[model samples]
Target: MKMNPITLIIVLVFLYPILKGFLFKFSSRDLKCDIDDLSRNISFIIAIISGTYFGKKIFIQHDDGIYRNIYNHIPQQILDYLENNNLIIYAIVIPIIVFIIYRVIKLILDLLNYVTTYPALDSIEKFLSSKGNIFKRTTGMIFQIPKGLCYVLLVAFALNIMSVLNVSSKLNGYLEGSKPYKSICKSIIMPVTNSNIAKKLPNILNNSFRIVIREADSGRQIEPNSDTPATLNQTNGRKTVVYYNGVTLDQGVKSDPQIDKLAVALGSEGTNTTEKAQMLYNWIGTNISYDHDKANKVLNNDFNVRSGAISAFETRKGICFDYSCLYVAMARTNNIKVRLVTGEGFNGISWVSHAWNQVYIPESGKWINVDTTFYKGGNYFDNPRFSIDHKDAQIAGQW
Candidate 1:
């Protein structure tokens, strides 16, 4: 029969101390020493397990506050480095802090044991020594069980860390293949450590791709007031466009002279609000391609969204956020009232975080939904069934 290497390793780890307990010959004095070692091992196990749980909880709760304090004192480059690698820093630093605290408590306990427990244990050891070899040996073997379990817990903790970090696919495969490891994690480690946070860490870290556009104010979608028009334009030589919610187009949307020029040229062909919006949308859908490289970086939380509109304009490539940002910029420049909406969209498999836009038609006096990102897929321009796929719509910004 074939044997899995990881399963073999785990079995060996579990069996090593049990074999030692059964095989080894020990005097009563040695058993007394083993008792002391068992006490220390039990304390160490409690400290490691509980300390890790509370430390992670505390860090998650106060991480933003800690970062803010450091931000004011550190150089921008250094702060950026810290922000980018904060998860790794937390993983290393929290364990060290917990170990330090454990050591200090252990020192106090050791001092108390020397003054009080040792003298009493000496009398007890002498009594046990007189009992028999059988009694002394049996007691000593029983103590070794907890010692073995302590080592098992340590291995489980290390595996948990590696899994959370996504250290290696091969190592992860080995861990998954090990039945002993899986049972230990499920029955013991997960309950103690609150492993849900560990499971969610990767998704939380990679959420930049999900929440691509930054929210404004409280980021809640408010229905437009009856007094507010579908479109607003202020003209005194320079045209200013506003949404039905009264947010000016230029506020969140970054403006570029080239984008403005192109928008003007496109809008000049349409002669109406809906037609102009359609022309800009069609041009973007035809010219721009989805940037897979940028998507990867965004997933890693490495891409910056500050220059997203201008970058998409120049490269003619972007993700959903970029498409929405570019559309808002161009539409506003052509005096069309628009908004950038963020929500989840079904990609025929699962609903993923996505961004799209809404344009106000002056003639119809209503705002219409549009998704240029799905332009290649189908007709997403004010489609009646748009709500079926796009869910939990929120107005990230209006222009």
Candidate 2:
């Protein structure tokens, strides 16, 4: 089962009290053993967890491109500030800062108590006393707040590291294909009669897709109930314009200097367009994989294509758009003409809306179709009749 972050938060909340009780038993001298103190500990931990959860969720929300949902509600400047700052750090540090403020207040109260004979100090003490120990209880809870916050920080840090390592990807690999075949295998018109495509047909038919055609681009299949394509194109052409326009559509594909440099290093050895394209195709196909979780999210209308290559290269998992975008990014960075194509393509089983690419070979004066997402030893690269599988294909930016 997927590890629900919400469930983890709840587990942590419940687990804290037991751990605290165990520690209290063993370290009675170091810790207090009052029921009220235990209650305060539990409350503080719960608060920290709640704060962390919502904070992380908001951070993810912005990353996932769903901030538009709250864009109107929040001022743009505040949203911009949140986007610029790391919410996760703030989430962990804010409570500790509050604890520090409490400590400062308590120190001032202590100084006032010591000088109670002074008229000003006496007046302040009387004012505080009239408030009926509210300040006392509030400041008293400060000591435990930092402890609870420290625990929260440790858990958050560990979780962040685990996410970076993509523990979820390992877990997903085990669960893939566990479910029975669910999609009916439809006979697709094989545009190219390649034996390799034939060999993979059975696997596609038996493999049940959770989101099916909705997840990937189809060359020309009518999308009846799906979100609009992430990219658009204004003009269509058959020559270098088509390829150049595709390059134009790619704005931030290789925005990262690191990835830009990696692209250069990978393709620098290639003496020609074909060799460079092959190197990039091999790198992507060998490195990346079809993200099932992301596909499921796309099926549920929860995926975005704004980050493109940077996200795909960093995460090493994405759907067709991601794969195509990275290839386009790398290829263009090396000064090779490439176009990001969107349409329906067969995935060994069914024809789905997909994204692939066409790289212009200067020597041959032709645009060779390349499906880096389905890269298998150049099987899907430069096939003379690639249009057979990649139908309804067009360049990505129109709108």
Candidate 3:
């Protein structure tokens, strides 16, 4: 059989302390001190486990309150900075805070133990030591097993959390190959952290940090496109405007005087909706540069669609979402029906979260895909193999 190095390492690490406890002879005084040290170690272990478990639950329960407090007090720029770097902050600050809390708690417990339990424990330790070398060794080993297991459990729990957050792919891969890690995770960690509240924690944290406050909409109604019929031949002759609850598809589309004027000028060159849509697509792809900085900020969860579209229009730089948002606003200004679609797009290396547009052309009586973000690469406008790379495509909003 092939020897699994990771499993061997885990076994050795787990057994080392237990074996040491069993084999190493100690005087009564030393054994008593060791017992005190074991108690302290156990207290520290319990503090960490309980702190992590309960801290998560408390955060989940009161996330909204916490968010509101922070949102109200912090400046917007500082909030943005914090939200952008929340993962790093949590990774570093949370552990340090937990450790500090654990140390304080351990100090209190130690002081209490010294005052109340030291005499009794000393008597017990002396009695065990007096039972002869073999008995003393066996007792120490038996006591050491639970402490060793606690150490393993704590390490495994930390690894499980890092794995859940996908902190490092290389580290996670190594851990996955370790049989002991996998076994403990499956048997112990999963059971404790797989509850509904625990499962919702990531999303809760994300939402709490990235707070978006949308104002109530004005009562202005969306005017139906006069060029096309109320229903199109596509979508089985469904109405041109899609609605959810009382909200229309174009509700999120933002516009300004500059955008409106530019759209009119762009669309004026084409005779029909298809021609106009293509012209607009070509212009956006050729003119607008992809903003890599904004893309990185967005990946860190510091992005706003309204702001993105506005910035893209004014600056001619944006990522996929910005491209799609700009397209929707411009198309709507020209009375060209368009929808912002968001999903994964293959960027050669991997599938990434991407946004594009689908324009309804009355001439073809069909809605076609358009990805202006890929203009630098090639024609993505209604590409037949579009589905080959773009997947899980869902309409975000229409205009």
Candidate 4:
């Protein structure tokens, strides 16, 4: 008969002691001890609290109590099939999981009790006579540590699987935070890895530029020529000193220590801002590709840039926002001043909302516009003519 979940929980609580007593007998028989009633009760409480608290955190709460985020990642057709047969799956699965948990907890408690009551090694030899011959006693002690570790790993693997499916905590966020450390290892293996490079330079060079021509529906020139003096640069009114001295840890531009490592590697060979900026521009322009799918979705809503830098580096694909965020991440991490600019620009055929960067040059005391996306058309650096087609929407954030 179907029962309320609250009733089921109360029933389990009342039955815990009966289960504990049965488990205690098996465990004490193995350890050859009369484990105290108080000690066993305490151990039981500790185990229940730890397992329940951690289990609740690992399993996402839902109407049914708890679940994995399997529904989010799986295809609709597969989910439909699973939903159609869920009762059969649960009937087969629940009992097996319960039995496994019972055995694991029993093993854990047995090990705990054994260790807590363990005598001195010299005393152990004397006790061996009461338990078994020395051979059986020695074998158990020898394997116990490794056996405990294996169970620990099994538990950890199960939790990790849950964590991966649960979107509240992102796997990519951990990787992004740790990328700097990985870059150090990468630096060590650079020479050997470089020799095996399979990406053809010719394909990259040939695919660098594209031309688009759009016939104007109105016989007028697509853009009105402006002799209007360029609008005051965003940097013009601000204290330039702050750009050099202050840190702007802008929210969307998430950076890690690895960017410092990357900056040193890329710009260490060049002394000037022009060279450093060019190096950064080239790396981003060639290494990353526009994410067509995400870009299409973004036109309908918005985009997230919190992990944009690492995501672009890992996937090698992103929209204009990703390009700008990654640029700012590396530049700021390395103590360079970079601003993410949101604006309107002609995407060859028609005007579209876009994002790019303006980098501060220390020696020149001026800002230079650099567009990685426009670099696809070649010659994107320090172009005065660039402002003619691109109009600033508003500056998002700067570092």
- Lowest summed lDDT over 10 consecutive residues: which window, candidate 2? 180-189
Taking the tens digit of each residue's C-alpha lDDT, what string does model 1 give over 275-361? 999999999988888776666676666634433567788988877777888899899888899998866564422245677899999
TM-score of each model, paired residue for residue: 0.43, 0.41, 0.44, 0.37
- What is the per-residue lDDT of model 4 for residues 339-368, given as tens digits with 9 covering 90 to 100? 877665533212345667899999899988
Number of colliding residue pairs in each model: 0, 17, 0, 1
**Comparing 1 and 2 on TM-score, the stronger one:** 1
Can you list the residue pairs that collide in candidate 4? 180-258
* Best model number under lDDT: 1
Alpha carbon lDDT of each predicted model: 0.65, 0.52, 0.61, 0.48
Model 3, which residues run further than 4 Å from truth? 3-6, 25-28, 31-47, 50-78, 161-170, 186-399
- Tens digit of per-residue lDDT, candidate 3, span 1-399: 864654666677668668877897534455556656666666666665555545434332223566456445646775456445544433654466468767877788778767876666577676775578888777667756765776676667666656545556466456655778767755556445423312321111111111121222433334423242222322323323433112233443567899889889999999999889988899898889876665555547554433445667888876666677778888988999898876655432223456689999888899999988777655578765356446656666666
Query: CA lDDT of 45 in candidate 3?
Result: 63
TM-score of 1: 0.43
Name the lDDT of candidate 2. 0.52
Of models 1 and 4, which has the larger TM-score? 1
